[model samples]
Target: MDKAIIDFFQNFTTSNHFILNNIFIFFTKIGNLGMIWILISLLFLIFKSTRKIGIVSLLSLFFSFIISNLFLKHLIARPRPFTTYDLKILIPLPKDFSFPSGHASASFASAFGIFLSSNKKSLKWVVITLASLIAFSRIYLSVHYFIDVISGVGIGIFCGYLSIKIYEKIMKNK
Candidate 1:
């Protein structure tokens, strides 16, 4: 099923279509190590109104990293789809276990964390859209399986919710 899904995406991509490949590669690059999400969190930190959300988003990203990247990746020890199969990925191959995509987890963690803490619908949608793109790029790039991206999204949302609750509790006690 995983291979089938990947092969399906392959139909949309061709070696001649460097433009499309570059676009997906750009999305995947921003998601690398959650750098873009961290930058967003830091930008939020610069404002007093968003400081709490910023902190919470950072915590959410941290939780996602620890759970998906550190623990589950090692525990499952699943190889990247590119390693397991002969898929032609758009970006440089990643050297790590691939069950539960770290990119998807971190992107959704920060996006959903901000969504939970902020009241603006537009901001929420924007972040969610970006996160979704990042998650899909992982599969589009053939770095992760469909199940891995889906599970990563679930873990990310859970971590984001957990961070929000933790922040609320801390603020209430203070």
Candidate 2:
């Protein structure tokens, strides 16, 4: 199933539409190192009204990085789909393991953190939409397996919710 999904995406890579490929590549680039999400969190942090959500989002990103990138990736040691299969990669090859996509995890962690912490429905939807696109871009780019991204999404959401609970606990203690 994973190979089939990847092969299906390969069709897009071979398509004549450079614009569509560029859009997916753009999503992946923004997600790299979680730079865009980090910037968003910092913007949230700058605002007095959104400070708490910003803090939660940062914590979520941190925890997701630790769990997905540092720990689980090493533990699982799953190779990238491109490594296992002869797939065309649109981006530079990642050196790390591929069980959980760091991009997907970080994207969701930040987005879900905002969703849980903020009251603005529009903000939540916007962030979640971006997160979804980022996660999907991983699979579309063939850098990650479908299951790897799915796992990353689950882990990222869990990390996000966990960060919120931890924040609440700390506040209560204070």
Candidate 3:
């Protein structure tokens, strides 16, 4: 089952490259800028009663990326897909490890964090959709394997949930 999924993603990575490439380029560019936007949004969250949740969410995401890249990547040492395949890469190859996509992890962590902090059902779906797009973008660019993106999603969701739980615990204590 796992191999089938990996094979499917690998095939899709190649077959969908054209479309994914374009979307990846756009999102990558936006992602560069969106980091700043997320910071600002986080700042806005500070003024509300939900400040603790926002901080925990943001910190959880930041730490998750740091630990993933700084520790896990080096420990696992997984290579990028292009390293093995004669794949035509659409974007410039990243210098970092590719086991778990930092972009996907960070984006989804923040989006899910916000979604959980706020009870807005509509906004949660929007954030989730955006997170999925970001994850797909990484695979589309040929920089990360299917497993990498899947790991990212898992990491992001875990950290996001942990952040929310911490916030809830803190709220109860206060």
> Please, what is the whole-model Cα lDDT of each candidate in the order they appear?
0.91, 0.93, 0.71
The C-alpha stretches of model 1 lying farther than 4 A from their native spots are: none
User: Per-residue lDDT of 1-174 in model 2, one digit per residue for the tens?
Assistant: 999999999999977658878999999999999999899999999989999999999999999999999999999999998888888888899899998999999999999999999999999999999999999999998999999999999999998999999999999999
Q: For candidate 3, write residues 75-165 as lDDT tens digits.
A: 8888887776666666677888887877777777777787778777886787788778877777766677878888977887777888888
Clashing pairs in 1: none
Cα misplacement distance, residue 3 of candidate 3 (Å)? 9.8
Q: What is the lDDT of candidate 2?
A: 0.93
**Which should have the higher TM-score, number 1 or number 3?**
1
Question: Judged by lDDT, which candidate is best?
Answer: 2
lDDT of 1 by residue, 50-162 (tens): 99889999999999999998899999999887776777766778999988999999999999999999998999999999999999998887888999999999999999999
lDDT for model 3, please: 0.71
User: How many pairs of residues collide in each model?
Assistant: 0, 0, 0
Candidate ranking under lDDT, highest first, comes to 2, 1, 3
Off by over 4 Å in 2: none
> For every candidate structure, what is the RMSD over all alpha carbons to the true structure, in angstroms?
1.0, 0.8, 3.3
For each candidate in turn, the TM-score is: 0.96, 0.98, 0.80
